[model samples]
Target: MANNDIEVGSRGSLPRKDYFEPLPAPMIDMEELAKWSFYRAIIAEFVATLLFLYVVVLTVIGNKTQTDPIIGGNLCGGVGTLGIAWVFGGMIFVLVYCTAGISGGHINPAVTFGMFLGRKISLIRALLYIIAQCLGALCGCALVKSLQRDRYNHYGGAANQLVDGYSKGTGLAVEIVGTFVLLYTVFSATDPKRNARDSYVPVLAPLPIGFTVFMVHLATIPITGTGINPARSFGAAVIINDKEIWKDHWIFWVGPLIGATIATMYYQYVLRASAVKAIGSFRSTPPTRH
Candidate 1:
């Protein structure tokens, strides 16, 4: 009887459910996986960029142009400049949420190339990302062409070019300043140290990044239509097939890449070091666990 009691007690004391041990941190070396992971990320970036361009171009074409008045004499829909900015900004908001984890949400070839130049990304990965971005842009342009069809002749698909009376110098300046602001925001928002607080990481980054694009459009729409992202400009320009736009496209790519490179350097050498010091201070203090 005593033996039976012991067994029963032991059985009762045992946990009702098995305790689960956490899976070990993934053993894949980052360097070893870098090549393949980057390619996957590039593909994700491409898809995301394509979605962004397609949505924005379609909206612009459908809303902005004056199609023949309906039988009842009314415009179907019209999204003005501000509305267009919102649409473009909103698309970025969605894409970043979807793709940030996969590719750091760099849907711009200039950004990818800049990071590569800064040594933040490997050369193999950068090439793959550029290829993906270009292909994605082409796909997006093709979609816009198909959707608009006959209307395509009237629609420029939101292609970037200097407005009449705006000089090449003015366009270059706008692109440089706009891109610098954007890259700076990207660096601040994504730096793990700056966004170390649990609440900020996933939520805040997208907002600022999206807002930056909106603000850029607001400021530069008249001057150059704000080609802060070269992939965006390329996508639209390809659809428009404007040789003049293509000739000036170098400014978009070069300016953004320069700005991103500068921002990355500042973040790495100055901001990151300060962040490390700040985090270190917290770590040195003993935690009083309850």
Candidate 2:
């Protein structure tokens, strides 16, 4: 077959070329330490994660607590689940858009892990990004506590744990699936193949990614408090410091990392990445003897 996309009745179209050109990120790029841009990227991750956790947790606390005293019940309250989902989604859109050029807009440790697993970022960068994100999350949640100490602890502001009737297994599974959805969207939205093929995808990638986050949150909020981002969960837990909430704390991190791994595998292998091409291709003519 020639070097072009070929059509199969059942398979749609298959491109002979991988069409992905970038070399894998180096495991240890010492030279990156000298680049101010590298540190800037780390800072961007920190600030973005900080803003993300701060805004979202504050919204959660306010929404849950801001009930109508006149009504004298929990019937009509704050923005509700729908609004909370929107905040998570919308904030992600804004944050990703603002810092994409600088830090690739990885506000979540799960996202950073997925990028590193996919070979899109260096190991060093990934480590630093995770550290920055976690620190930022800690600070963001601390800020909320500082302003509303009683409400923060009293209302269970942002701590992630299984609600009543949910098992540890259920919590873990939901986190895995939630993070899988998020990382899958991130990979698809940022794929170079898609960008080169679809003229508009690169410019508006954040929209779909943000929408996915919103959708995931709406699905998982009542069950596990939607802990797709480990950093977000960590920050909230640390600031809230409820002993009961720590029982299932590992679910948030382990689940999301597992989800990220699954998504990476699905994108890189199941969806026909370089690994598929490694099987070799047909030749128009057989090789001649040397």
Candidate 3:
């Protein structure tokens, strides 16, 4: 059996290398907490989230004006529900394209939590990012309030609320399913193998991710107002300042976190597996044989 004569075309049935990254041990590396890039990423997350909230909330207000004569602004000239979806989806694409390199463009807390579970980021980093995102969202919504003044209160500030006939259970289900779709797309688009194969299309990753948000909004907007991102929901709820809107607030956080957990487990354990040890492994001894 000469090595060269064995077979060239018959190995196509073999499996490819697993691409999953293992969990990082010590998951709270303080050194990562000390890096300048870490702080820079926090800033990027904050600014990206701020811009995202500002733009999307404004679009919501405009949509409200058209659909509800009581508001009466109609700046979008009756753009309707479809237009709101486009605004959310379009803003996600632009923001992700701009901040993907900086903070992974995780304007959503649920996405950041998903990455954390898959060991794509440290626990501390994830926590900081969530905080920054929440703060940015608040500030963004506050700015909208400042500019819109009277209209801001009248238009609902784009808060997520369960509409008529929808119970708390229904709202929970909507957030879970919507966040799952989004987190799944986030994981797939940013998969190392996918990025490698699609290197020619540098911008392709964020497009599908953004489209996921767009499609989810179209389906869920009339239900729970689409709380795929807990931070987005929280910021709006806070500014809306009505105890009634806050009643179901727990659904947004619980549903999205659960969805993120499920998506991360499915992707890391089932979608891809890899030989590389998880970075930051804290084992007392190496696994190599003597």
Better of 2 and 3 by TM-score: 2
- The TM-score values for the models, in the order shown, are 0.76, 0.88, 0.85
Local lDDT at 283 for model 2? 39
- Using TM-score as the yardstick, the better of models 1 and 2 is 2
Better of 1 and 3 by TM-score: 3
Compared with the true structure, the alpha-carbon lDDT of candidate 1 equals: 0.71
lDDT of 3 by residue, 1-290 (tens): 01111111225554333333233545888997668988999999999999999999998886777667555654457677788899899999999999999888999999999998888888899999999999999999999999987778987899988898988888898888888899999988887665434453457888999999999999999998888998999999999898878888899999999999988887776665422223323345533321
Which stretches in model 2 have alpha-carbon errors above 4 Å?
1-20, 68-74, 279-290
Which 10-residue span in candidate 2 carries the lowest summed lDDT? Answer: 1-10
Worst 10 residues of 3 by lDDT: 1-10
lDDT of 3 at 213: 95
Q: Which 10 residues in a row give candidate 1 its minimum summed lDDT?
A: 1-10
User: lDDT for every model?
Assistant: 0.71, 0.86, 0.83
Off by over 4 Å in 1: 1-36, 66-77, 273-290
lDDT measured at residue 66 in model 3 versus the true structure, 0 to 100 = 69
lDDT-based ranking: 2, 3, 1
